[model samples]
Target: MTPIFPAKAGHSVRILQLCRAIKALGHELTFIHVASKLDTQKPDIASHVAFFGERHFLHLDNGPRQARFAFWLRGKLRRRWRKILRGFGHDHSHYSGLDENWRNPWSHQLRAMDRRFDTVVVEYAFNSRALDAFPASTRKLLDTHDAFADRHRPFVARGFRKGYWVSLTPQDENQGLRRADAVIAIQAQEAEHFREQLAQYEVSERNPEIAVVSHYIGLDQPLPDHGVDHAALYLGTNMLSNQISLRQFLEHVLPRVVSSIPDFRLRLAGSICNWAPDIPNVEKLGFVDDLRAAFARSPLSVNPTIAGTGINIKLLDAMGAGVPTISTVTGVRGLGGEFNNGLLVVADHDHAAFADHIIRLSKDAGLRRSLGLAAFADAQRWNERQLAALDHCLRGDALTDTAPGHVARWRDRTPPPFPTAT
Candidate 1:
């Protein structure tokens, strides 16, 4: 359970949910958050989940290993020392997704502590160090939240090769699949895509024991009234995809919207440094403490995303707050909805046309409110409870009787092949 991303990112959030759900199922849970320093901005989120069970931090020594005489040999000694250390390297705090380089510290430790657990639930494929460390007896499993290799397409498309991200693609991903006891895809389409593409990436065609698991949300209690904010808002915490989407939006559409509507302010929030577009209507709100509050303040949430994987969490948070949304098809792909009727899904990729639609929604309060209500209701189904099966799977509590559906679908699905981490 080494959190590869910062504690607040979607991966960490899902990990916390899986662990807690597993704990509730009468199994023990442990979280190994590796790091030299914890991202202190949000200790409470981690703290809330801490009450359930074990939390450990394995920090490796930071002293330099390279000397002037044998700089080239430094890598050799470092590799040996890495083996000696065997668990938990420096905390990769800013990594939004998994990278297969720098032997992850936990894989080795978990491999050594093999006796403690019967199965290894690898949340991401970056930690091959763990794959090697995995006990011979313990089973391995992967939850393909995103096509790990797809994220690296940018580097590949750029003609660059033999870098950290390049190695993570296909190789480590396939290794994870081949070695794992099972592979769980977040969406059905994605599961099919994984099966079809693994072979293209030089992975086995007889895909691993694949299963489709929906993204988890905390689908508990009657949603409270999300008081309204009339402004149109966009929020992102420095994800590159978000930046690309924002750039597209500003470059193509904001001028028309600002000119047409006097009060229309397209507020941009989150970790965009020096990214204030010169467009008249676009206002940068910066990152907020609780984005839910920002959603509460804005009646309309915009999802101009072009590329990203997994459920857009910001969309769900907005839906949870009962905020009406206008998102591109890709952005709205996995969010809960009925026949595409739940949210104001806009297919017009053009920013001006999309902004025109936004302007129209802004004028009509009834249409805006309806979209929010329906979206909130739809979000109820995908909440945290849905991940119970995933939790059970991770704990090796997924024997047939307990999860016959899972067994029928997954137990028979042959083990998948994933690439070896470089």
Candidate 2:
């Protein structure tokens, strides 16, 4: 169950992929979406689910009324309260109960369903409170897309004041994680983090089991004939990390590339275009209907992300489409450090060097073809791994803690030449 409206956010994409994976394992699947107040019932939602073939989709009229009301009320308090706190040069984080709306109606809905399924999979940790609604007979699984605490750490370290209403406490996060029967971690780093956290909570018996399921493009490989299209593409939802990355690219990298290539075109696609800055040589294509065709039109995908959590769906999608990707080391975090594939990694803050690599890839079709083919091959392998991992989780097998070895493998790889020696 996901606490979101239908959109192409990375988490939303994961929910859809998990649904398909569940069905592929020959299990009956039902998707219960907790509609946000901003989300009206989307007729296209049913059509979208139909694309996955057969699955039952249930959209609650809207999220729990009380929680939404509280969310609104607390939002007002945080806005006013923070100003007074800032006057003293102090930061006091308030935890709002409003954020987790799965208390009454959502819980009731699950109880009404009456443990009909073998397991209940909750998409985000914020929504884990809903796990309490399921019967003892039902296996509760939590998909920790990213460790919420780790996600907030970067923001807090820079003294960036978080929106208080949605602020999460370490205890609050651990409570939800500890309650789960099992956890599906998006990356190996997070899988290890979850294990260490579980030990801190000393959760025994019902201790949350951990499984690492990295993101993957479906089994379909890209056709080699699509050929390089001479443009750089960026795909993202309207999240803060994406906004910051896009802004950085525009400010630091795009100008340099434009000076050299003259007609260099950068296409920013998805809901992210809504907030991305206006800049020269960049076309903002908001919420594209055909992402594959978008990739076909732009052979080079750029991920300039400096801070974000979980496996980047855009990275996987571009590689899956056999488009060569150039990104900062932070952009490629959680993904294994394998530069032999079609991925180019640059240092976090190198603007000129990043531009040079962009120029190199843009000009060399053969290099693009080689890297793209390698990426496609890597994606195919990941598809199999994701499916097998999902199958093990569903079959109730004990998941080995793969994080230590996974992290070791990544650390063991000789660091790729940042801004490849051009």
Candidate 3:
């Protein structure tokens, strides 16, 4: 089950694409999800769920009397608990800084709808607890969006809390994956990591089955006009990691680019615009309904992500839209053989170099056109390869090339398209 409706978020896009692909391959699909109480914006849930033959939304019981009494009892108990913990010189922080009832609070409802499907795919590590509510006969699949233990490093390093960090510890990820009959990681690196982790728990030669299925956008040909807009698009939600990346882009990269290329502009789209800095020439277009129109207006896309795990689908989306992209190393991980190729440019987290690349590309119309076309081609190839891997994994194929080190078997040795091509 997903934590929210398929808004413009990366995880949401990945799930919808996978569901559509699964359905297109002649398998029935259904979605089991919980709503995010804090987000009032309603995404097009009907259109997304239309691919699936069935849908179920699990809701929590919250009568007024029950809510008031629960709040009162929680406050009373929290005060007493804090007092006792303080007496022992321990920090009694807020109880589980996660969404309320994140641990399968609606499992009773989920359990009732369990037997209808032969296989259940639970998305996100936090919602893995829902897997436990399913019957033993049901084949459970865990779609881990990222390696959370690694993803939480930035938060942990910022002194978030031991309790919070512990919640995403490696053991916690292991617990979630261990429960699944099969596991799907978004990146190849993470998929390998899961196999190693599961090996420790399994006595046999094979442990929990695992596969790498990257996000597939299946975008059509390049945007028509590559000459009109000199804007660099930054599209993403207000995820903590995205906010950090956008802040860095504003503070470090945007100024240098604008200085070198006076005509350059930056457009921030998606929910992250809520907290983004209002800088000169940087327009914040929050929650745009048509992302392709935004991409069409911008020739270049930049991802200055400082800290995050898993593949950045935003970067891939830019590539899919047939636009030239520049990203830091952290933003381009798990892109086998795509890094530093002609598909996109890469800068070593250096703002000056990033700005220079932006300036260089801004001046060369031919380079931009060629790179965008090449990116479109690469996206098509990667989409095919990833789909094949997904089909293989779903068919219960035993893990191949299970040797220790990082496997590069999926890499395409074909060279990127020529930049001089029309």
Per-model C-alpha RMSD: 9.0, 6.6, 6.0
Residues 173-227, candidate 2: write the lDDT tens digits. Answer: 7777877887889887888888887777645565678888766464455646545
lDDT tens per residue, model 1, 26-123: 55555544432223333443454445433442333222444222534554665566454434532222122233233333444454453466666655
Residues 77-133, candidate 3, lDDT per residue (tens digit)?
A: 866886777567554332322223353336666766534777788776666777788
Per-candidate Cα lDDT values, in order, are 0.56, 0.70, 0.66
**Which regions of candidate 2 deviate over 4 angstroms?**
1-6, 37-45, 48-55, 61-90, 150-153, 156-159, 162-165, 201-206, 226-229, 338-340, 398-422
Q: Which stretches of candidate 1 lie over 4 Å from their true place?
A: 1-7, 24-26, 36-49, 52-108, 154-172, 199-207, 219-230, 335-340, 388-392, 395-422
- Candidate 3 Cα errors over 4 Å, as ranges: 1-6, 36-45, 48-105, 159-166, 198-206, 339-347, 398-422
Candidate 3 least-lDDT 10 residues: 413-422
Please report, as a residue range, the 10-residue window in candidate 1 with the lowest summed lDDT: 413-422
Instruction: Assess the local accuracy of residue 86 in candidate 1 as a C-alpha lDDT between 0 and 100.
Output: 35
Ranking by TM-score: 2, 3, 1
Better of 2 and 3 by lDDT: 2
Q: What does the lDDT read for residue 355 in candidate 2? A: 95
Against the true structure, candidate 2 reaches a TM-score of 0.84
User: Candidate 1 at residue 302, lDDT?
Assistant: 85
